[model samples]
Structures are given as structure tokens and as C-alpha cells.
Target: MRLRIVVLFFVLAVGFVLAPRAAAQSPIVVVSQSLDMRFPRSMRFNIETKSNTRITVLRLTVWQNGVAVGARYSPAFAPSQHVRAGYNWSFQSLSEGGYLPPGTRGEYTWHIEDDAGNVHDTPRAAYAVEDRLHTWQTLSNDVVRVSWYEGDAAFGAAIFARALSAREFLAKQLNIQDIRPLQIFVYASKQDFFTALPPFSAEWTGGRMFPEYGVIMINFAPENSDWGMRATSHELSHAILHSKIRGTLGDLSVPHWLDEGLAVYNETSDHAPDDQFERMFQLAVLRNTLIPLRKLEQRFPADSEQAQLSYGESYSVVKFMIEKYGAEKFAALLNIYEKGAAPDDGLRQVYGMNQDELENAWRDEIGARSREISTARLPTLAPRPTFEVSSPLASPTVLPTASPAPTAEPTRIAQAANPAPDTAVPAPAPALPASGLCGGVVMLSGLVALSALKRRGGRDSER
Candidate 1:
């Protein structure tokens, strides 16, 4: 009987040892997470894991404004001696495969699978990635608003006027009367400006429009104030075009050429016929490289030089339509787009001509020959402010305000136009926690940076 008791005790001890592992399998502990906007294609995340585990699949999926932009996956490994696996990230080697555009916010989650086939998932947390160098100052009216840094209040006022004035003119020209909240972000420097953009954004791009969010990001250098406002007007034209179209039509997509040409035509200044555009335009004509107007409806050339020439061609073609056909016809063509009519059908209905005839007439009028045309799918290039169009309904946006004191996370301007209700994707079933693993988790952020400054009060006491 004593021997039997001993055997039973041994079995009980073994069961106790294995019971915890079988009954409760806690998720992987998140040590820290961050995204360096400088490299938008990569995600830097750290995790705590068991020593014996090998991470076979580590995936990250990002959802922007409720739209799943894309996902990136990687293989990662961790050491048992050190519980921390530092910086396991998915590098976006493909052009559009894992690219994340800047000046946007999204919810991202980590999905991890271990060598033993155990799976772990993190809750989708909201993240806004934009420039956070200085505290912002905002100036607003009913229809339009502007926000800048402390010393840029004057620039903000100037841009405010520019935004409203351009809005009035575009609305009158388009024969539309509707309002969408337009928020402008004015960064103080070029580096700060680039910091707010995706990697492939062009160097010459001074401003961009996010129609999905109804926001504009512009680099406002005090030294180049005049040119900065011009970019402001240029981007505002795009904002007006996109917002008015959405307000009028439910959610119709427009062509690139018409979209860009109208934005360019609204620019405050005009160049001579033989100016900057002529150089690239004439070269494309000499080489026979201009994309057909119908083909250009999709995108321009991937080559920057050829792309600029495409812009010139688009502007010239759009300008010809306006001059020869008149703004009334331009409005009518927009009406067709607003109605979601087919592009060629709209071309035939509005202008009584096909795209080929239109392209030939425009090229002939410009006294230039057409180029060797290729129909390859062009990667969406910079300065075009390419993005997936969101629903016309606006989601309740959060505009972040920062205090003089340090913040754990940079404040964001969550302001949205025609904001819609939030929609959250359901997460996977969570596993029960291991005994000690159920303890508190701390998020690593900028809250611990030490700050000390000497000061003298009015009473002459040093502080």
C-alpha cells in the first residue's frame, strides 16, 4: 500500500507540472512597438518570447481609415537566455506590396506563429504617423481652417485667405455649392515636410492632398513664402475638386489627366508657351513618347522626366479643351464623371470626339508629334497624391493637440470632412494567460526623457 501511495504521489506531481502548460497558453508579451516614418515600408516591433520557441511566421497587417492597405510577413527567431527579441520587422522589398503612405493613420496588429504551431495575436491599436517637431497653432473659419507652428501664425493667416479664396473661385467655376471641412498642415521646414510623406514622394512636391481624410500637407518655408502659397493654392485646387465631386456624386473616381490638369490650370501664375513645360514637351514630341489621352486616364509615365512631360501634355490638353470648348463644357464633362459614366462614353457625349481624336487635335494644335506609346501599368508616382478613395461619409476624426510639456505620443490632427462612424475588425479568440505572464505590461514610449532647465523667478529664487 505504501508503494502504491508513492506511485500515486509521483503521478500527481507530473500532472501538476504539465497541467499549467496545457490549460493556459498566454499570448506573446509585447515589449515595444514603433514605426520610423523615415522608412515607411518597414515596421519595428520587439517581443518577449520563450527561449525554446522559433518564430516561423510574424505578420503585420495595417488598416488605414478602415481599409486594409496591405500586409507584410517575416520569419523571426528569439533567444531563451534573453527574453527580449529586439526589432523584428517586415521589410517592404516590393514596390507596392508592403508600402505604407505617410500623413495617414491606421490600426495595426501583429500575428505570430511559433515552431510548435501555437499562435498569438495582438489587438489592433491606432497609430498616426506624422511630423511632431513643434506644438501647432490653429486658425479657423466656418468653411476653411489653417494650422501652423507658433511663429507661423502669420503664414497661417495668409494660407487661410488663400484657401477660402480658392474655394470660392473653384466652387463658382464648378457650379457647385457644398462644404467639407478642409484642414491644412503647414510644416516649418523641408525635412519636416518630407518627414510627413511616404518614401517615393518626389522632391519637388511642395504639397499633397489626402481626399480620404480631407487634409492638405504643405511645406511652408518662411524664406519661400510666395512659392509656398502657390503650392497651397495648387493643393487646394485638388481638395476642392475631390471634395466637391464627393459632395455632388456619392463616390466617383476621376481620371488622372483631368484631375491633374485642372489642378495645374488653377495655379496662380502662367508660364510662356516656350517656358519650363516646353523643354520636356518638345523632347517627348521629338522622341514620340506621349501616352495616349485615354491611356493617360489611368496613370502617367514612371520616368520622372517623361512624367513631367505627361503633366505638361495633360495641362496643355486640358487647357486646349477649356479655351476651345470653354469652361461650360469642362463643367459638363465633370458632371459626366460625377455621374460615374464611362470615360470614353463621357468623352463622346460631352465633346463629340474620341480620346484618339482629342489627343491628335491637342498634339496638332501644340505643333508637336506624338511619341512611341506604351500601355504598361505605371507605378503611382509622386506629386500626384495617389491614394485609395474612402467612402464619402466621414469618420469621426481626432485632431491631436499637444501641450508644452512632453507627450507620450505625438499629437495628431484627426479632423475629418464628412466624418463617418468607426468600424473595427474582430480580433481572434484570446488564450488564457500563464500564471506569471498575467502580470502588467508596460508600453515603451517617450515618457521617460529627462528634462531640466534653470530659471529665476520674480522673487530672485533660482528654479
Candidate 2:
């Protein structure tokens, strides 16, 4: 009987010791997780978890909102049974190559692991990295969305209508029907405009495009509707053209001339050249100071006059190609570039001539002398150039002028434009797995192309 009692007591002691161990082995439970998006500064992610054992690892995985892959971060936190982990994502001092644009929608998840080896993954949450300082209203169509904080509904509508027109025009011109959706954020003032862009942005930046993000930003009020429309169309052209040429394997390095030329040409709905741009081209032709198209294959010169002249020359060259060779052949040229053909190589395949020959052809058509060809060639992988298209303050008949009065809207303008959409809808922020341009899918490879436009004052625009 005594031996039986002793065995019972021993068994009870063993049960008491193992009970806690078994409880510790239970699965970890996430109590709560949230993201606080604070614009112009940082985003904060906080998560709380409960577990029987000490929480040893707390990881946060994030990617641009529609992207499949992302980077993982292990936040510093003390080990504890019930723990709260927080991480602050900063907006300051972004690397020139790996910066996220404002209005970038993102997704995040928490990876929690405990000392007992139990793991728990919280459901993914979505957030927008946007300017939260002001209230914003938006308008969207099937292909595009326009967001604004300062403008009235009419202002937003006008921008949205113009964006749609540009989209339709470019789609027809490029023979691209299945275009991804795009977002445009128009800031009413210059201070607000520069606030949204990267710190490295130049002072002359009037508008900017983040193609990988499907985003375009510009600073224009209702009174400057003509420039606003032109700038909007210009950036939209870049975004659309990029979508057509950005390949599954990698982005084809498009020649700066072709890229900016197409953008300037598309500033007007009818694809008419800007008068100021034409004048700049004519002036350069007379002075024999026209920068060779080969040199422009990589980037334009930094001098303000040279930059203006570069845009003018590019516009003239692209106009010549389309009017002479036909739009179908131009579309075919883009296809060749998408297949990874070199700049001159693609031109030759499409036009039966190389860069020099094409330049001579364009020159002859324009009544200008042929440019001298130098043997010097820029590196195959030249530093990505910033393209800046100039938006002269010329009002075209194609786009209606906005009401100069701060409070009143013209009956014609309001009637023609659509109202704001139901919500500030986000477009697909897809990142290529090959390059870390859109989001850091593999590594921080940054965007292959970051283009900007000069305001009316000729601030050195870098596209």
C-alpha cells in the first residue's frame, strides 16, 4: 500500500512539471497589428503577440502593394512572453536609386516565432505611403485616377478628363490596348509639389513621373490649366510608353531622344509640336550648336539653354519619324526595343538606318546640315538620365482653359469633365522580379528611369 502511494505521488510530480512544458508548446497567437502612415516623415508598424514561451524572433515582411515578393526586416526587440514589436519606416534621406514615391500603396505582415519554436504569421495588411497633411479628393476612370487636395471637384475633374484623353490618344498611337491603370496627384502649389518628391529633386521640377509606381505628380492650380494639361499629358505619355516597352525579362534602355521626343509630341491631344520647342530647334539649327543625336542617346546637357534645345531637337526628330515612317513602323520599333535590341540596332531594324543615318534623314527633312559622327560611344549601361520636358505657357485650343476666378467654374469646362470617383482607388503597383525598381523584389536596384519636367520658368528639368 505504501509503495502504491509513493508511485502515485511520483506520477503527480511528473505531471506538474510536464504541464507547463506542454502549455509552452501551444501555438503563438497574434493579439493585434497595425500600420500608421504618417506622411513627410515615416510609417510606423506595431504588432502585439501572446505566447506561453518567450518571443525570440519578430520579423516584418513588406512589399509594394500588388507586388508578389518583398524584403524582410528583423526589428530589434527584447525577448518576452507577451511582447509588442514596433518599427518606424523613415522617409528622409532616401537613396537616389531605391526610393518609393509618395502615394505608393504597400502591404506588410508580421512573422512571430517563440522560444518553443512555435510560429505565427499575421494576415497581410494594406497601407498607403501618401501625403496625409491635407484632405484629398479624387476622380478616376477605368484607366486613370486623379487626386488633389487643393482643387475643387471641377479642378480634379478637368485633370482626370485630360488624363483619360491622353491615355486614349497614346493607346491608339502605340497600338497598346491592355494598359495598366495609372494615378496622378496634382499639387496646387510648388511647396507642396516638391514636398512629395525625393529630396534630390531639382528646383526646376514642375512635374514628375514614377512609371514603376504608375504615378504622376505635378504642381498646377486651376488657373494654369493649360500647362497642367500639357504637363499631365507629357508624363502620361511616359507612363504609357514605358508599360508597352518594359519587358518581362528587363526594361529596355530606350534612347533619351525617342523617349522625351514622344512625350513632347504627345503634349497636345493631336500630337502637335510646341511652338517654343520648335523655335528652340530652329535657333539651334542656325547656330550650328545642335547637340548630336548620338550624344543625346544617353542624356542632355545640364546647361539650361542646351536642355531646352535638347527637348526641341528630340521633339523634331520624333515628329519626323512618325510623319515620314508612319505610326505602325514606330510601334514596330518599340516592339524591337522591348525584345532587347540596342538603341541604334532597333532604329536600324525598323527604319533601315542607324542613328547617324536617321539623324541625317531628319536633318535633311528639316533643312539642317547633317551632324558629324564621332567614333566615341557612351557606355552600354550609362547612368540613368533624368529627362525634363519643358511646358511653355502657351494655351492650345484643344484643352479648355480653367476659370481664372478662384470660386467660379465655367459651364463648358464643368459640363465636359467627369466628377470625382467614389474612392481614392489604387492602381496595381506591380514590381518586376528581375529588377528592384518598383519595390525591392530582389534587391534595391532602384528605378531604371526617373523623369521630371521643367515648369514655365525653365528650371533645369531632369526627366
Candidate 3:
């Protein structure tokens, strides 16, 4: 009996030791921060905890718009705790995926929890966001100003030179002069570039451009001049193309297919006859899922698979237009849009063909199904080509756009555009992708194609 009593006592003692301890008394936390979103400037947080009670939770919540995103850390007290949490609107955003790019408004707050079951919330703080990148090192010309970190000054100049060459090419093709003061931001490292994006940005996105500010953000990995120059050229085409259309029409109302097509067309690749885009496009054609020009002109599929088809269709059709019809006639088509001519009217006037006629011609040349997609009959922003599906040549008021001469050494053609379904933008989506384009699945290995089409109907609306 005595042994049993002793055993019971021992068990009780062990249980007592194993039980969770009662909460410690709370500590008093007084926190402050000197947040400056500028380079050659400081960005961090300072917290002062003055209490015997232990801290359980300490975190900084970076608020963008009203949404919160941040990191938690181990708590420290007294002797003036310093947290090196800096704020740079040019780089960090916590609100929405891209709650705030530079030149936007946002707020942030801190939270603390103590062992005493006590919680603390800091007052909301505001940031005067600006284009802090402007303060970075710069290389400029009459048309563009290239911004870069000190380490990438020479690279910045190189891209600037390449951009000028691209500008000449785009202007000649679009038949428009460059007037905008373009600025390209060259991130020395992908990490730096990624850090500056909204949380929702996709991994595939390598660069972005905003026509509003004439801003372009591209990454340069030390010595990869080939990619840097190519990317620079690709983005420059967007700026030039949009500015030209807007200049001509007094509004940037160009269609996505046309806009993206023109951009991809300007891509100069070492592998001149790659067939990736062609195979993907052909697959779509064989599947009988080719998006009719009507559906493609207004908006593209939000699904990647469906979206790839649209990109492929756009690139293919545009390539066909340029090669089949003379570049001058194509320029005239753009001029029609500039004059506020409807797409159908523009086709009829320029090529003496309606939308249907053009669609049929493209389908036949590519050996795609001569039949029209049935889903295309569903509601779309604009009407499909007027030519009947039964006959591709139903309404040719003018001669066929195809060439009669033997094809000059046939080259392979292929590519598809982005199909981001979840990303949302706050600004009017640029009628297309900003060049937010970075997060898109532009899958072609070397083509600066499929820029993430942030269909944010606002701010960055698609073309």
C-alpha cells in the first residue's frame, strides 16, 4: 500500500512538470519606423519593448491599398530593438498582387502579441510612392532614358543603343515617327526585378513596360547582351506601336491580335526558321479550335491553352498580312484604324476584302481547317469577317492577297500568346499586357513573346 501511494505521488509530480505553464505577464511595446522609399536612402523599422513579460508574436504587415502582406519575426525587448524593414515603393507591394507599382498610394501597420494574451496594433502608416528608380544611374538620348543601378551603367547604354535601332525598325514598319520620351529600367539582377513586383506576378515574366509613363522594366544578367537587346527591342515595339496608333486615331484602340502580332513580328532571332510557334498553331488548327478573327480581335481566352491558340493565331495572321500584302498596304490598314475606321470598313477599304475574306485566306495558306469555329458565333465585342464561311473567297471586291510568285525559301512560323486567368489589375488594362507582361507564360524560348496579358480592364488594359 505504501509503494502504491508513492507511485501515485510520483505520477502526479511528473504530470505537473509536463503541463503547459501559465502565460507570463505582458511586455509593453513601443514601436516606430523611419521608412524612406528612396535609394541612397534608408528603409527599416525600429521597435522598443519595455516589459518583463515575454513576447510571443512580432510581425510587420505591409499594407497595399487595404490588403496586408508581410513577415513575422522573433521578438526582442528594450535596449531599442531595431528592425531593418525598409520601404521602397519602386520594389515592394503588399496590397493586391500588384497593389502598388511606383506612383501609387498605400499604407502599412505592425502587430505584436505577448505571452500575457495581450495584442497590440500599430497605427496605419502612409507612403508617398514615387518613381524612386529615376534617381538610379541614367544613360539617355533624345528618344529614351535608360535607368540602371551603378553596376549596370554600361549595359543600360547598350540596351539604349539597341532600343534606338529597334525604334527605327518599328517606325519604318508602323509608318509613324517616335515622339515619346521612353525610359527603360534595367534591373541588374532578377531578384531585384522580382522584388519590385506585386505578389501576384508570375515567374515567366522577365520584363514589363508602361506606355503611360513611357516606362519599361527589363532584367540584365551581367553579360547576356543578346537577351537584353532582344527584350529591349520587343518592348520598344510596344511603346512605338501604341503611341503611333494613339497618335493616328487620337485613342489607343488597336486590337490585341494586331498589337501583339506586330510586336512579335519585330522579334529578330538567330534561329530564323524555328517551328515551335508553327507546331503549336498547327495543333490548334488540326484540333479545329482556331479562334475566329472576330473573337480574337476584341479579347483572347483567359485559359493558357486557349490563350496560346489566340497568340498563335494573332502572330500568324499578322505575319500573313505583312508577307502576303505589301508592308505599305498593311500600313494603310493601320492608317484606316487611325482615321477611326471600323475594322470591317478598314479591311474592305485597304485590302478590298472583308474580315471573313481575310480569315479564309489565312486559313487556306496555313492549311488550317477551312471551316469556321462555331463558338465564334457567340457574343463578341465586334462582328466576325463578313465573308461567308462556306466560301473563303465569298466577297473579294479586290484581287486575292496571296502571292502568285514562287514562295521565297519557305521559313517556319510559330508562337502563341499569354493566357493568364487569375491575375487582376487595378488600372485600366492597357487594352493588353503592359509589357505586367513579366509574369506571363511567353513560352517561346527566345522570342520576346506572350507578355503577360493583364486583362485588368483598367490602368493596364490590353490592346
lDDT of 2: 0.65
Native-to-model Cα distance after best TM-score fit, residue 187 in candidate 3, in Å: 1.7
Per-residue CA lDDT of candidate 1, range 360-425, in tens? 778787777744445664443222222323322211122123211222222222322221211223
lDDT (0 to 1) per candidate:
0.53, 0.65, 0.53
Selected candidate, larger TM-score, 1 vs 2: 2
Q: Please state every model's RMSD to the true fold in angstroms.
A: 17.1, 13.7, 21.1
Best by TM-score: 2
In terms of lDDT, the poorest run of 10 residues in model 2 is 439-448
lDDT of 2 by residue, 1-463 (tens): 9999999999999999999988755478888888887666777889988898899988776666423335455677899998988877766533211346676766677777788877776766777777777688988755687888886888888888888777765556555444566788888877787777665555655676666556777777776677678778888888767644653224536787898888888877777766555677899899877878888886666555666677889999999998998877787776666555788778877899888889989899988887777677735533222221111112211222331111111011111121122232222223321222211100011211221232333322223
For residue 41, what is the lDDT in candidate 3? 29
Tens-place lDDT digits, model 3, residues 376-448 = 5433234222211111111222332322222121111121121112122222211123333521222322222
What is the TM-score of each predicted model, taking all chains together?
A: 0.51, 0.74, 0.52
Q: Pick the candidate with the highest lDDT.
A: 2
Candidate 2: clashing pairs of residues: 386-463, 387-463, 388-463, 451-463, 452-463
Residue 107 Cα positional deviation in candidate 3, in Å, after optimal superposition: 24
